[model samples]
Target chain A: MTALARALITLAVPVLLVLLAVLAVPADGPTCLGIGLRIWALFACAPATSAWLWWRQRAVPA
Target chain B: MIAAFVAVMALSLLIALWARRGAGQGPRAFFVAGGQLGAILFFFLSVGETYSIATMLGFPGGVYAGGEGFVVWFFGYILLAAPVLAVLGPWIWRAGNLYGAVTIPDFFAAHFNSRLLERVIALGAIALLVPIGTMQFAGIRLVLGALAPGLPMPLLLAGAGLVVMAYVALAGLRAAAFVAVLKDALMLGAILLVGALALLHWPIATTPVATATMAAQVPVTLPFALSTIAVQALGFAMIPQNWAFLFAARGPQAIVRAQAAAPLYMVMFPLLMAVAVFARRMGLPVDKPDFVFLAAAQHLLPGWALGVVMAAVVLAGMVILSSVCLAIAPLLTRNVLPGLDGRAQQRWAQGVTALFIALSAAGAMAQVPLLAMLNTVFYFGIVQTLPGFLAALWTGRVRAGGVLAGMAVAALAIIGVRLAGISAGGINPGLIGLILNSVVLTLVTLMFPRRDGHSVMAMLR
Candidate 1:
């Protein structure tokens, strides 16, 4: 993939994860699991996305 | 409590004096700590500035009044913003180093070759920052008044402002950096202790279970939560004070390490949110939502513990207030009055710092709005600059004229919408302004593309 494409993908992953969590998690009812899922996705996705972007930038020639 | 307050303030002053030692004299030392901060100092400084009185007082108060839904979006935005920072912060640091930029507008002016744009941005930043400083002033008053019932509010406000100005004017960013170490340690300890005590005293249910059930009952809609998180996360990333901290890093690598470690520090928020919920369950009488954290401490903890927590909260306010003042000083000395010599600029910065603090203290005394509302106004205004900043950072296609035009339109739109008191279907005004700003920017850029041969990122590299 091109560098721009890689950067776009890197940005998209976190936003996509957050959107999924926001939409899938019910506002009412047994939300312990839902809240946990949202929090976990955020915690996991941010660092994961950062690492991916960093590695991609390194792998590609500037 | 008063004795504890006196000791903390004395120690903070000594730390400021120590930070001043060996630091050379000039705008560079005062504004950017002579660019000597290492990874650990950078980490503490960035986290310390990021989690201010807002985190300690305003946040739990939000959770207390609004319920667990507040925590969801609050942490959501904060968590999501970090990765973006991890990517962009290093670039900002590089640009600042390359251009010898002390403020956000300095970077913009140097990159765009437009002194006019720099002045406009500086004016916009000052306008936004003063209200934020006012919010911090109000927060200090709230925590102090709750902790010491007999103390005079105006006297406390003036004293807090003076102390903050003294450290910031004496040692500049170093004062904030060193004080941050103590503030963060005290803040974290106090938060954990409060959380644990609240849980112990009012063990109604497991934390998750209680918070989840509270989340269900609150009126926070999904749309509101999602939009709030999106706009606030972007705003947080682009706030001027945060950008200054980014520029102060020793190198891009230091910023990366700091960004990676920041979320770990935010684990305190959830613990504090639990404390707020516990306060609610325990039938605490909180007239003002912002008092929830202090109220919990007052009602639940021992006198000595309450004193320590009060000191921590006060330190949080002072450290951030000092940083905000320092952030604004550069805009005045460097951008607004660009004709001054180095010595004159430093002198004028100190003068401007004192004047700005006085204005904010006066606004805080008026107390026309609540603390959180003042903060929201700041966020709404600052994020309007993001389109301009991103264009400058990422592309050569967008011109300075286009960016400024977009920002102007967005600012007017924000003011109009806010004044109308329209919610726009649960969307935040900042997000709306950002969307409109980007659209205008794209249209204007297509009409008047930059003739520069290289992208800003490439040129900087």
Candidate 2:
């Protein structure tokens, strides 16, 4: 439920932005979700690379 | 005008002296205020740390110069930083408290049991942090130059420099914490006063000049906004000094609470942007673009209020930065020096702090590109630490060999990325470095796991 809420909240901004732009770009309406997806990609991003590097350090038990 | 600044300096120094008396015991008090700071003190100091002279001065100037792109960077910070702090801060606080760690290297040494690696991390932190300190000093000179134009720049710099150095050397973080109270009070008063005056002087429309300038500069498209948020968010979590605040929190719960509360800082960004928009509309000629706060304060405020604002911005930079450098230097000296007694160790640490300050000040004078590049360059080191430090505390199985190796790879990759200059397009290389670092650590740990020190981990949990 939290994830659903988060996703909905995140999409709301881009959706509004695209909707506002749609009156001008009638043919571009289909591409709005693609735009939303990219924005969502940005939102979902974290500093995961370091977590990956840290996780690589598992010591072999003696 | 000079007399006013002199008066402020004298008062700041006296306040610093009085405050220094309360700090109990030795290095811990000097470095971390013995971890006894209250919430109000913490809130103000943390905010003062955030609202550096750069943010106070350069941020408005950035909006004046580049329109809304920088505003995106500014606002995204709260989003990026709060969560990272919430999750990581508590763990670090617990570990730091448990080990009685005074510096980042102390914690590193305790976790890895390798003094050599600890010293290396210490040196990396000092090397990166110096430029940040230098910028603060440079900012002092700029404010003084504008406020008291008749006084020589060198004399003004020297006066401000001596006050900062004395307070930091005498009272350490306790002095900084107390001084930050005055600093934040002046800062809040100045920001609000200037903001109100600018609004009155040139009342902006609902969609201000910044929006118009940015709209003219770049189309209000999805790619622009997405990329803007992406770069800012990534860079926000990777700002080395800001990220290091996690280690200083009272505990995990304190960190978590601080993170949850930090979003309040974000709400003010748009307000600051509005002030800049008003300033720009009123035809403020800002060539350097880092002089907006001082310019606005001088032009818009009464003489007494202007003096207060100038002192606040300068001291905010000087005090916080000096404490940071002072705290960082001992971490290196203690780990690197061999067979020194406690007194000798203290003397050496003080010397290192002084030297670090001198070198960084010189770099500022020289205008070295390396120092200028420091804002982003240091994030590489911090990203490397993320994996080793977090894993060691969270799960007992992470081996030193694998942790160190993963760090090495991440460091190399970040350096390579930096050399390519791809990260300089405002995207954070540290974020990419972090991802690589975590992945390597995870894979290598799973392949070759350690079971020793499992009991220590259990105790913490």
Top candidate (lDDT): 1
TM-score of each: 0.90, 0.79
For residues B1-461, write the lDDT of model 1, one tens digit per residue. Answer: 67777788789899998988777776777778887887788888886754778788767777666744566677677766765676667766777877888888998888788888899989988988888878778888787777667978888888898899888867889889999998888888888888888767864443332442233323555566777777777787677778778877787777766766665557666567777777776757676777778888888778777877888888888888898888998899889998898789778878888888888888888985655566667877778778877787678888888889898888888889989988788777778888999999999999999887355577866
DockQ of each: 0.25, 0.05
Can you write out model 2's per-residue Cα lDDT over B58-98, one digit (the tens) per residue?
A: 66766666633344444344345544444445545666777
Model 1 — TM-score against the truth?
A: 0.90
Give the clashing residue pairs of candidate 1, or none: none
> What is the per-residue lDDT of model 2 for residues A1-62, given as tens digits with 9 covering 90 to 100?
43224323433443333333332333222322112232222222322312321232121110
Q: After superposition, how far is residue B318 of candidate 2 from its true place, in Å?
A: 1.0
